[model samples]
Target chain A: MKGRKINPKRFEIGQLKIILLILPLVIFMGMPIIFIINHAFKPMEELFAFPPTFFVKNATLENFSKLIKFSDSSGIPLSRYLFNSLVVTVITVGLALLLTTMSAFALAKIKFKGRNALTHINQIAIMFVSTAVLIPRYLVICKLGLIDNLLAHILPLVAMPVALFLVKQFVEQVPDSLLEAAYMDGATDLDIYLKVIMPMIRPAVATAAILVFQQVWTNMETSSYFFSDDSMKTLTFYMNTLVNVNNTVAGQGMAAAASLIMFLPNLILFIILQNKVMNTMANSGIK
Target chain B: MAETTKMSRKDKKALKERMKHLKSGKLERRYARMGYIFMIPWFIGAAVFLAYPLGSSFWYALNNIRITPLGRIFSFVGQGNFTQILIQDPDFMIYLVDYLTSTIISTPIIVVFALIIAMMLNMKIKGKGFFRLIFFLPVIIVSGPILGMLTAEGAGSISAIDTQSLTSAISSVLPDIIAKPISDVFNNMITTLWYSGVQILIFLSGLQKIDKSMYEAAKIDGGSAWECFWKITLPNLKSMILLNTIYTIVFISNNSENPIIVLIEESMFSGTKEKGYGYASAMAWLYSVVVLILVGLFALLLATRKDQYEKQVKRAIKARKKEARNKKKIERRNRRNAKKIERQRAAGKITTHTTDRSDY
Candidate 1:
């Protein structure tokens, strides 16, 4: 039987057919990414070349140096925005992970009053576009006196409905018998949650972490809306201003460089945690 | 043996019920308390961030609000803001129509593209991870400003495709209203495809979860690949398709690049007295309702339709059950008539006689 069996993973001549079909589409899909990198490296002449070049003939770091020079001339240095973004993203990701996992555990495993209702609310929350909540969210932030406060950035983004939904679905997959076994050993709920549940849902936690990080990292809304002070502004907001302030032929290079800088962290994080993200997606389909 | 097994099963159920009773009040209460303790942060967060804002936003939509250095001033305007947005606002209606048409056209394209890519990736191929990495790259890098910059530099569409000719051809064949969005889709084709990054992964994961033996069985039965896909794969993927569709719609609606969102943001900051917090809230409400309706429409379209085979089987079963019921009814009526005739004959009100062919 073993001798006659076909190996599923072995490469076959037939596989070439699929590769041929997919290769062109993959290249087509990958063009923008390639363009982004190339555009960032293009020298001034190539950047503005008529019949825009897809690939850079002359690669240069002039844009990066010029961007640094421009930011240095401004009142707040580039480091300030970078520092603010890093701090906010780290804090928000940490808090959101804790909130989401805890709430998910309660909603999924615990048979309690209002659990169903809370779950339903989270589901409904997923349907709401952020724009729908923008006005009231601003008003709430104002009433809470979070204007210009770093907490404003952290608060509105912490309770992510989609993250909760994903995490809850994951937590539900933790077997009841395992939890009961822990309970029989006189383990407290916190002990079970921290020891038993957390270990099982590591992929979900990682996924949620990446999600919150990306959101807080790229978010300019919080800075543009809440922060009046230039020093407190995030890198994304700063980048936006950097490009818009110099919206000209010369500014195009700086804009390209800034986009690359902004896009790099998300790309790196995803590359590192891509496996866990795939795992989370496997469980993400609406049942 | 069956009797013994049945008795044991009953006994087991009784024992389970007794255990449940024994563990009822105190233990259940303790778990409930623990659950609430676990949910405390979310409760606070939801109240401050979700419920409170939702309530206040609805209230804000109904009134005219001005933000002054001193404080916020509010005047009751009832449905005036909604009416103004619906009737009086020129840009709102135009942008809304454009948004609706574009979303309706682009969503199916994105989902189908994602599905095709997902299917290809699922096959036994070399460099699967590399392809997946490239495919999923967009989800991470895509942001409002970055997308804006990319599109500005004409990186949003393929350099090879002659969008000008394509758009002209589309416009020549189609009406102005319909052609505009189709042309826009072609012009920004790459960005539209980029929107399907997460969707591709979603489909890939779902496809993986399907039992491979089902495909094997179909193959053994001499089914073609196309037949297997339509009969087996498509039916199994119904829920995932709906999920991806809804996700695509919501993502498109809320995207910062979306004109309606940008319009709302502008109106909220506008210095004009007629526009501010109240007007933006009204617009947000209206936009959200439209998004909800779109989601509902897609959900109804994908979810409510039963599979053709399943529907036929259900109808067959119903017909069979109706035939059985009719047979039972006719037997009962014949039995009642026979009993009536026998009673009458015994009581001397009638006599039973052998019938000829004419009587039949």
Candidate 2:
């Protein structure tokens, strides 16, 4: 696992040239992110300052405290929304990882009738914009009697086609000889899936997990469409309502605080699992 | 009687062979069954979630649906909603045109920008991971309402750029329809670039996979860095470009911030009797078709054509084969002519002293 020693390129003056070119873009791209962070910490007077300050002059936690107080005053506390989001995200990510990897294993390794057709179906499913299927998907949820249920959020997002595609590609790289050896030792298909395939394709699973987590965490559609009750809604939905209802000048600080709260989890998760995510994308291109 | 006996022997042999084949395939059949077992959840999920919804959505588009207190009422109105959205709804058409143009304009910019950043990050530079983390931060936090808040607070653009003069100049030169989306792209340049975070990583991974020896070989062969990039790097990364382009298109089209998607959501829950589930379904159907067409067009545009170097090599090989075949053909024709003359001379039809002009 040692790094290669004889690479032709070295860190020289040429490297500084690239740094110069990229430094400006990196700063440009990082501006909004910096702005988001600074905006959240700004006190009321600075938030509404003319010619809007790029950095916070009077940085304080007042906006966050105000946001917490406002939410506490409401009947449904912000904690309830956060709890709901966590539960939904956890269950969705777990179930989606299981279903996607298992299905990918079958499609990639096993010789079966209609396997190509199933893969084709999944590929075509990737092309479907979720908006196109909204009404009927809603109808399906209603018919299943999951309208006010938490399962409504978890079920619809479980079958992710792109995740399946990526994992299946990773699974195909599992040599046939490895599977044969496992089978020769009297292991069943499920055993191989759990012990061998699962261990090897960990990077892909992590990638899929991150994708499903982001999808479920940020998704406000289910709460908006399926659930009519406010108590059952997620943090994102609540944040959105908070920002929209109080669009007055006094509400800007609180809105900025809420945006930061929602953004922090995703940033933290990516920072932790980024290497695995990069590994997964390394094999994602169509061959 | 003899033929019947032979035919019976052949039939029995065929039956025996069939039995052997079936016996040999028993293990494969078991594996196939196991494959189906593993696939059971997906089968059920696809049928219920994907197939049924698609079928019902198409049907919903054709019907006049009413969600009432007692029960849902469905009055079948064939193409009524489609025509209404196509002809009557001004917002739908305008938003559709805007979505199409902006998507077309921004997709390449996003992809190319991603490629440039990826290439920069791929170099042997200091703090590569730090730069990557900065570049990729956008993908994590980019959601509808959050982005809406950011843009509303004027954080979507650089303060230094005078977008007013730029927009004015662009509008003066071009027509209104085309000019508007281009200016919008410039205005939200940061946000548009943010869309490329995932694309940048995708490109970076692809760049890493390109064998370093190819570049070394090119350098040894006296190829300039620019030449090496166009010849070696670009061709190898062609498929990745196509993949990233399609991903960006799908992502942008389905994003919650997309105006067309917001429009559909509004019409779906609109208080008006005319605009409800049925009308929204029709609008979604139209919008998705546009998205699919855009994806198809970009796919076609970036689809890996046969490599130019390989094509030229193939052409040269084909020409050599054709030349060899032509040489053989001429030698055979000369041999035949010589043989014919020798036979004629032996038969005394022509003598060496009196050579015929036809022999030449």
TM-score for each predicted model, relative to the true structure: 0.79, 0.79
iRMS, candidate 2, in Å: value is 4.1
Candidate 1 docks at the CAPRI level of acceptable
Candidate 1 lDDT, A1-287, residue by residue in tens: 11111124677898999999989878877866787888899999998888777899989999999999998988888898888888889888898999999999999998899989988777667766576577678878888998988899889988988788767756776668888888999999999999888866766676667667877887777888777977888898989887888899889899999988988887787777656534432322123
A1-287 per-residue lDDT for model 2 (tens digits): 22232223556776778888888888877876887899899998888787767799878999899998999899988888999898999898898899999999999999899999999788667767677687788889989999889888888988888788767866876678888889999999999999888866766676667677888888888999999988888998999887889999868888899988988897888777766544432322223
Global lDDT of each model? 0.82, 0.82
What TM-score describes the B chain of model 2? Answer: 0.77
DockQ of the candidate models in sequence: 0.40, 0.41
Q: Model 1: residues >4 Å from true position, as ranges?
A: A1-12, A73-77, A101-111, A129-132, A142-149, A166-209, A248-250, A278-287, B1-38, B140-142, B146-180, B211-224, B227-232, B305-360
Alpha-carbon error at A59 in model 1, in Å?
Answer: 1.4
TM-score of 2: 0.79
Q: Which regions of candidate 2 are displaced past 4 Å?
A: A2-14, A75-77, A105-111, A165-206, A228-231, A248-250, A278-287, B1-24, B27-31, B152-155, B158-180, B211-232, B307-360
lDDT of 1 by residue, B1-360 (tens): 676466777787887778886856887899899999999998889878887777688898898889899988899999999999999998988998898999999999999999999888877787777787788777666655556656777877877899889889998999999999999988888889998887786676567546677889999999999999998888877777886898789888888778889898888888789999888988888888898888889888999899788899999999999999999999999999999988998898996576889976
Question: Model 2, clash count?
Answer: 0
Candidate 1, residue A199: how far the Cα is off, in Å: 6.6
Highest-scoring model, DockQ: 2
